[model samples]
Target: MNSDAAISCPPDVLDGSRALRLACETLDIEADALRAMSQRLDGAFSAVVQRILQLSGRVVVMGMGKSGHVGRKVAATLASTGTPAFFVHPAEASHGDLGMVTAGDLVLALSNSGETDELTGVLPAIKRQGIPLVAMTGGLQSTLAKHADWVLDTRVEREACPLNLAPTASTTAQLAMGDALAVALLDARGFGAEDFARSHPGGALGRRLLTHVRDVMRSGKDLPRVQPEASCVDLMREMSAKGLGCSAIVDAAGTLQGIFTDGDLRRCVEAGVDLRARSAADVMHPRPRTIAADMLAVAAARLMEEYGITSVLVVDAQQHLQGVVHIRDLMRAKVI
Candidate 1:
């Protein structure tokens, strides 16, 4: 009614509470959409897995607009999880990229409306290559769906957008479906951590899976070693010098006999055992946990956690001392 009243508060301008409420509402819509889609995962879903698993070549994924973006992610997830998938833009596929699709490959095309011109334009070529088509679409009767060998109906009730015009809920549903397909294929292939790490060698997961105890352990001079007959003071000196919180008690032949940790030192002190008079073998833990040098560093971490200890002795098959692997070494390597 007046300039001051008009300036007081704009009806379209959301406050903090309204903003959070709107955000939550969007998430709720997507969550419900995913739930509905999850229920539809039945025989048809299994059929897609069957086709994918039977293939000898990679899966070529194509889509348009927002679907194209989600398709890229789906392709990456599929590839990284051992399915060997890659994205080809539908428009580009109409060019020379269509050659990338071979007879052995399967085409996974995404189109919410199922009639996207860019997508349908390349469908004939895919069929020409004798590539089985798997369509993820809302319209089951649309051209892409009608022509596809298998249809994954990713139909959502509505979009999360207030205007119901954006591809919010539909895209989220598509991504979830892609993840489901990837995980399912991974399981069917018996794809383990080693397979995944091979695909992602530059990441922390790769380090955890590929790095062995010998790769991270302190060997030779860096290792804190002492003869079984060495004095407790000498053991403590080796522990402090190496800063590994423990010393490996080895025999004259360099065979690991025991380990003397700071914890053992404390107990010896509490028991009134003279540190200068006692030998490392007299106070050391005779049955300390040891891991082979060939074991995974993550496995070493697990062994330490299982024993409630800070470090473990690295040994060979003959109980020969190889090195010391400390929890801090694992943390530094980002393998923990």
Candidate 2:
């Protein structure tokens, strides 16, 4: 038969309702497996966490087939969260990659059946090297578990697969177990968002945490500012030249006294005040929102958001005008 004919299903068999029912059943099975696993947690789970915490080197994760795929994800999560880890394929380890497992490192091997030959083949070498082994598997008495120093039971009653041959719920349980381990380790090490951001410097969280106001604020000649006694024409000229939509009113010592924005200009116009005759202080909004140069750029975004303002001045300890951070500046830096 052609490929299409071989895989084709009857109309009733392939109905949308049946497909949705199957999807719901798969999710329910997996969710139940996770709940059962959560209830089964005991001292063994705590011991595994303590073992990983006490390790001096990285976690070397290994497995075969589908388990290996899960191992790779587990290793990546652990590495990014604070615990250093990497995946080494079990088959490759038997060849020559076993050298990657160093003295102080810990080995986390995953195998649902706990009897993968390629995985079991290297257990003796790992044991002889005096490295600690933690096995995540269903077989309590299997060779893999027997050789392991710590065992994390990941046994599921059945796979989510209809035929019960493919790994579905089992892999979900293993992945959840791996996540639990990483979260526990993260808490124990006091790994906060800033610490997490350091590992992911290119991510959005990193941009928010690592980027400072000084890095994105317009300073020097680019900053729009005028003396409090300067004419309104001078303030308008500075605002237009700098294109920040606002100008700072500073005193002789460059101390920020107030800010005059286009909104203030419109309000003055509505009140029939002549801009040509006014000084900077006559129309400026005193004590405008200000942020420190060392503050996070995200904090500047927050202040702008909270006050419903488009621009804010960066000030020193004495409230001296250092720079101006417009909403556009935050956009250009991708900090907002």
Candidate 3:
């Protein structure tokens, strides 16, 4: 829908598509504001980055209302990305959280108007602590900007809201800018995906990066295995007993020769084979999916999916059998 149709539509009522288009327009305005901020990033931005780099303590982000919410998210992102940071409500900081701030910590104050009474109220205390302050705001003359050791200019011409009252484009700009800052600091600090995973230990990326196949793969008495010279009937029994739906076929020396799965069993049954007489090698896939025991669980899961299999055999460089990984294991462990 076009802007004219959107405007003519009722205040409280409009078609879903028109509303979605308006929302997209608001996002576009914010995206443009972020672009403007990026273009303005020069030596001043570098100076702010240097100051943050020198901090020995956490980045205490503080703000009110929407800015406070944005500050919380920014702090979380910074923490997970290698910068030690946390959000402290300026009002609450006045009460007791101010103690969390020490002389070594740096402050990132967020205020759209740059004159929030609650945030401004803490300036004296922040000053007394001798902690450096970095201001994110629209007004250069605001109390926050005036006192900031490093001020990041977030000024915007106007908001995307038609009423010019809601914080639409401004908040979006703040979020995008905050992300840029965190990412820059991340790069400067040499924070990699593994470092991020360490910070977000319970999140999916953490599980993927830190979890190994050995942590999730079936081993020892739980592993399913059969010999190449063994009968298919007995191997099927092993698969059923282990509940792995598959069994690795090893040579006399315990080297992986092949893999026998339910799919292989189906093919054997269709081929009219005498299950009791057929050897494991006769029905097994000679080159089955295999991975290293020390490989990441996520990589093992990907190999299984790419091959459309339910289990992967763990082996050494010489194909010595070690263990087995079941698709269900990855699912249960939440590695997939």
Give the winner by TM-score. Answer: 2
Q: What are the per-residue Cα lDDT tens digits for candidate 1 across 153-244?
A: 99999999999999999999899999999999999999999999999998999999999998999998999989988887788889899998
Question: What is the Å distance of residue 305 in model 2 from its true position?
Answer: 0.8
Question: Any runs in candidate 2 off by more than 4 Å, and if so which?
Answer: 1-13
lDDT of 2 by residue, 1-336 (tens): 787986684555457887899999999999999999999999999998998899999999998999999999999999999999999999999999999999999999999999999999999999999999999998889999999999999999999999999999999999999999999999999999999989999988999999999999999989899998899998999989999899999999999999999999899999999989989999999979999999999999999999999998999999999999999989988887
Alpha carbon RMSD to native, model 2: 1.8
Which runs in model 3 stand beyond 4 Å of their true positions? 1-25, 251-253, 281-283
> Which segments of candidate 1 are over 4 A away from where they belong?
1-13, 267-272, 306-308
> Per-residue lDDT for 243 in model 1?
90
Error of 3 at 275 (Å): 4.1
> Each prediction's TM-score against the native?
0.87, 0.97, 0.87
Q: How many backbone clashes does every candidate have?
A: 0, 0, 0
Model 2 lDDT on a 0 to 1 scale: 0.94
